[model samples]
Target chain A: MRDTIARCETTAHAEGLAAGLTQALAAARDGFSPPGRVAALPADRVPPGAAAVRNRLAEREGIGCFVWPGREAERPHHVRPGHETERPHHDGASDDTTTEFAVLLGAVRLGATRRLLEHAVTHLSGRTVGGEPTLRKQLVLGTVADVMTGVEAARHALLTGASVPDAVADTHERLTELDWETTKLLGASGYLADGPARTAHVSRLLADCWVAAPGGTP
Target chain B: MTELDAPLRELRGMCREAARDLRTRALAVDADPADVERHLDSPTLTLIRVASTPKRFRADGSVDDGGYSGSCLARVIAGVELARGDAGLICANTGPSLAGVAVDALGSEAQQEAFYDAIADGRTWTFFGMTEPDRGSDATAMETRLEAAPDPADGMLLTGAKRYVGNASRGRIGVVFARTGRTALSVRGAVVRIPAAGYEATPLDMIGLRGARICAIDLNGVRVPREDVLGAHLPASRRGLWGIGRTFNVMRTQIASMALGVALAARDLVREERPGWSGHERVSARLDAALALLHDAAVQVDHDPDARRPPSVAKLHITDLAVRTTRWAAHALGPGAMLEHPLLEKWCRDVAAFEFMDGTSNIQRLHITHDVATRATAPRPSAGRVTTPTADRVTAPQGAA
Candidate 1:
């Protein structure tokens, strides 16, 4: 069980890194040049690709537009009514963006848990504890069923969180606990660093989840 | 001990038996989406067998044992029971049953013999081709047209298309709703044989209820014999506009019953998996309230066939509860809920259809509010309370009353 969880977690981490690198490469191809380099250029002087990327980021975050100096642009205004001037007009996350982020976190969490359950099902079905399959098999099967139920709850919370404000926090908390429980179920092999299963480790998945989670450390 | 419970108990038993029968097949259409695509071309016989059970159908093509009027409520109970087993199967069962009710209630003696008799054996299927791409619950706005054919013997020529017509691809016969004139108010029903010339059906890809066999039906000047016209010989009031309404009167209840079945199934699973869920005061309270509303709707369906408000109220409340109950079940199940539990996910998706099909929950609300407001103005001894006519009091033949 431990080895399987470690395998899943490693796989998620590698996948996340690959995705991040791909996005970075795409941004570079679009002339954003990554990091602090693009911010130094004038809005109009920026390459079309860079400008396009900026616009997409702005729109998704509910920043409305890249208001170069005093020039305001028409975009979906996501700024809260009272804090319009208190926050950066181009970087402020709107309620919609927050909900989107919550949903994204939920997706990552669900993917990891799905892998965990699949591993458990495969592993437990093949192996037995104490040289007997009956009681241990029942226990494993029952736990997996319970996990299935929890995943559904998390899914509902994630879906509702997309529209309901309070639901986001509820789903985030639910998902965080799910991640922990899955990791614990697999034990030391799940914590193993250099094993053949290290590639499937869940640390990256957990890290990404934390970064996306409400009140996340990152 | 109530009149409603007796029949409901029997219907429930039938539904459970059918569900057990399907489980034995282990089709797993719900667990694997690929099975849905595969079955689209060749529908599995599981649902057809369930629908055909001697318990559901009679030798005369009418539902066995269930009375003509009371059959509506009985079907509702059966739907609830079927839903508990598999919501996709409910779709398949109701697809034909919907057409049966319309034909039995509105078809001429000859029409009934041809259409109903064919399905009496439980092996045949019928489709209700009413929803068009542009028109749904407001079916009066349909674009499908039935024009007077050039030859009198050719009957009516139907042109235009129906989308989301359940069982159309595999049905032996279908009842199509079309505009008799250019005006929206001229809409009427026509029965067409699946094999008729210029008629085409294509299976639709659906998010849920894969077994329902939903399809798009196109009629390119499809000719229907005059005898196939749903209410050709009936009086104006009992045939066209009024006929469809009576059909809905029973259909709406059955739809609500299907939704209730999904909710009941969810509630049962939640109870079994999380036995302590009922111990939670708020959860128990909600369950009690939902069950009470469901039972109240069932009782109203059996006792008050003519009254619009009871069924409307029942449908409105119960469908909403079905969605909520499934969500609650998922919530109770927790993180593991994401695991593919075919029944839970299917029920959730199936309940969504109830909210949209027939008169939408919003439309039901509109009717209920209108009734309440209209009642508020009328002066009488039963002024505050609304009293519906008993089932026998209703006079219209079973079309849209």
Candidate 2:
């Protein structure tokens, strides 16, 4: 975790760290406050050090990050000390079981969602699996989907002080490339089998999801 | 009385009333084919009758409010607009109506007024007898000649055949252009209106635009009165290239507008039938795209009719789009649309016909290339010397005489 923090130097990097920090803080029961004075901190702050490396990473990747708490009243900084961060205590054995159940359930949900999306995209494209055309389609859809997945994963990874901005940006670049590829394919298809509609729908879904993902908004 | 004030005002009111009545009838007969045809055909005849009289007066040497502001011009334009509103009607009456207008434009003032009064009274359909059997695009190469005799009593004798002479069979007056001299340098345009007995009109069968009755006219020694000559009663100047250019510009834009109307009708048909198809999603998107392109082209020509190259380009683009879009709609609608229904098949034929009408797509391309190349190589005029008028010829009709 300290190694991850040592790599980040920007606000996006810090917010990435904050996301991981959130999970860690939740685990540790220690109230987590981002370093630096709250009032003076930029809206999107990364941790100190690795400035040159972080800038290079941002350029290479397409990630950008901005903090968007649900409401000003419920902001992390505004939470009351004793009243906030409360969870019902459980017996040790029950707590462990609950954690295991949560992990397994999350894995299953993610796997199912990925499979459904893959099936839908393949059906829409009318390309055979393992063929050159299908392979190309898969590459485009996978690259975009993976970038979105990475952004989501980075939020939790930030608990361990990972550079969330770099991860989010890299995913964004891949997503943009995927969008271009999809539109070109659809245009070339001469709109066979409702290709334009499918292309438009997927583009809109990806754009919306990208904006909503942690450290992914431009 | 002023030439057209009362008559034109009356014509305007009648046209508006007729147009309104037709629109109501069209909507009421939306699903009834026979009723729609009846409603469309009647108003069309009325308009044609109104338009045809002007040409007869022009041929008889009577009306002369020089060219543009003449009562004949207003009546002709109004008739064209009304005819154009319904494709079936335009297909039926345009040739005869245009024949009348053409005579007024190119005929002698005395001939003009005579034809105008005749057409106004519904006595005759005037024929514009310019096009020859062999000379179509190249009018100067016309073999038909008029020979003048040295003897004063002999007068000028017109010999040779004219083809594509609209309203020739039934017209009382024929405005024929013949080569008074053989050589290209000696080519001259003469407007001669022959009595029906002096000339023979043979109807020519053509594909598409079935309603416009076209005929090949054979003028054999058709003698005209010496005073029947248009514009000072002298031979037309061979160096009048500018007049030809202006005429081409106006005619091409008018044809483009006609093509636009047909394309729009096709689009409406497609929209109506689209929802029932399995490929509705894809078809709708393409339909939207095609409509946008058509609208852009229409607006460009409508806003600047004299922009020259854009009008031809728009005509080509819109006509091509219409052909493809209608073909798609036909495919989507399946066998039902493929049948002799009013919507798809006839419209497809109409669009295809329009593409070849005023100028072929190839000709339009050549014009565009030539215009571009000429502009590029030509010396630039000083800034203040080059002025662009804000008024568009299409929207603001000129009152020139």
Candidate 3:
């Protein structure tokens, strides 16, 4: 399992979390069970990229891609028009949630978040402000290092599985903070409706829908 | 917190009453920013316009509210109450806002008249262009260039682009800062009238503060008459950086006050959502303490407008606190709070704007640390508090005095 996670992290660093996660889901064998031991919804209920605990068991059966309503995605697992019944897929089918999904999603979101920081570093280093590279400024460097530290902290927290509810909640907060801080480093570009900020924002909503509370269904 | 005297206390009560109208229009503006135009005449917005305007320029020429415009402290007091109503709604209102402070500080008698007169009609929107696409808040590194006009009689040619400016597309008139030479002193502000040749502004798609109408501007040799140059008659030293320093110093406290107000609003919403949750005790106590800190910063600005550290500390702390408080509001409302409560969701979005408005948290921290490093050892930030009404006398002339 750790080897699979490391390989996905490498792919996410090179490509993206979605690409890495999709690859892992596709390659896994049919007999495999996700850590959560959670059951899948009906096949039709899943999608182009739903974050359900199903991994390539059948056609288009890769686990990935949780998108809520009114948000952007590469391949949206959206609520169909007049399909209110399937909303638990978007609004969180907490009952279907499992500790394993939280553990896995944390690692996945961190991988994506780390990618955002790399993008920010590239943007800042490429640009010059007041005759100096923005990335070289002491304050900018300090902020970058702070976010790097956060990624580490979040990575450590995700490695542990004790207290599923608290771990999930803490992971959610940590990754979201790192994402926001990294976005600010991109300046006005970060506020664009698309790009790294959008990805980070989607990751936040994805966690909300997938992670469960102490008394939640997961 | 310093005890509010009767007049200031009464002013806060009136603002609290007026804020409900801001809440009434909040969701509508967020849904459709253009809808803000239809609701601009609410009592709360009108009061803000009147209070922000100098007494001599007001249409009614009445200072009915106690010290709403009277002092930095008074405005800070009212800023908190007004934003508590709906920060987005306040940003949505059409008035001589962000630009008004700069014009008041830097404009000459004739220049000030031109600015205020252009926006005399309640319907007119205004813009203050400073931030650029490449340079976030580093105004000193501005690339917008102001060149000599072909014909000296035409004054100057202003050519530059600005981004993240409020009301840029809709503003009939505004002030944009540009550089005439390599030196910082060469930086200057020029007022440009819209509907002229070679000046265009396009609204940017925003994640939040949709009502703010943030935009990107393209200037192609926009003509600026010599008279429109702010601080044209002032000494070279005071023309550029000085007024910016003064404007930011006074404005920071107000920004902090409004940010604190949003924090309070989020706290109240959590209470409203969970009627008997004692988990909020720690949050409430912290908010109360932040309010005191905000008031202390306001007093400090009133006492010495150029004091940078107090405002920096206040803005940095409260901006992040407001964002954190809104997040707490979501958590307290339980899972799917954002999906369930539209207002809380909108607030979470709107609060992010304050973090980037004047400066980001990183920038604010730099200011605080830079100032602390320069100063000798001193009392704590909250020390030497001045509670007297007279301490609020800095901007009193605007109060129909």
Better of 2 and 3 by lDDT: 3
Please give the distance, in angstroms, between residue A83's alpha carbon in candidate 2 and its true position after superposition.
58
Query: Which 10-residue span in candidate 1 chain B carries the lowest summed lDDT?
Result: B333-342
Q: What's the CA error at residue A36 for candidate 1, in Å?
A: 38
Higher-ranked by lDDT: 1 or 2 = 1
For model 2, the superposed segments whose C-alpha errors exceed 4 Å read A1-218, B1-41, B48-85, B94-96, B149-155, B182-194, B233-241, B274-311, B340-343, B373-401
lDDT of 1 by residue, A133-185 (tens): 42264434566667788888776666555556346645655654554344333
Off by over 4 Å in 3: A3-97, A212-218, B61-66, B372-401
Could you arrange the candidates by TM-score from highest to lowest?
Answer: 3, 1, 2
Across residues B169-251, which tens digit of lDDT does each residue of candidate 3 receive?
88888888898887767778888889779999998866667788889999999999989889887777777866677788778
Top of the candidates by lDDT: 3
* Each prediction's whole-model lDDT (CA): 0.53, 0.41, 0.71
- Candidate 2 per-residue C-alpha lDDT over A38-150 given as tens digits, one digit per residue, 9 for 90 to 100: 11111134334212111111221222222222122232211112232351132111233322222222222222233333444554356433334443554445644664474
Whose lDDT is higher: candidate 1's or candidate 3's?
3
Alpha-carbon deviation at B221 in model 1, angstroms: 0.5
TM-score of structure candidate 2: 0.46
Top-down lDDT ranking: 3, 1, 2
Span of 10 residues, lowest total lDDT, candidate 3 chain B: B392-401
TM-score of chain B of each: 0.80, 0.64, 0.91
Residue B116 displacement in candidate 2 (angstroms): 0.9
- Write one digit per residue (lDDT tens) for candidate 2, span B9-35: 565455434544433333223232223
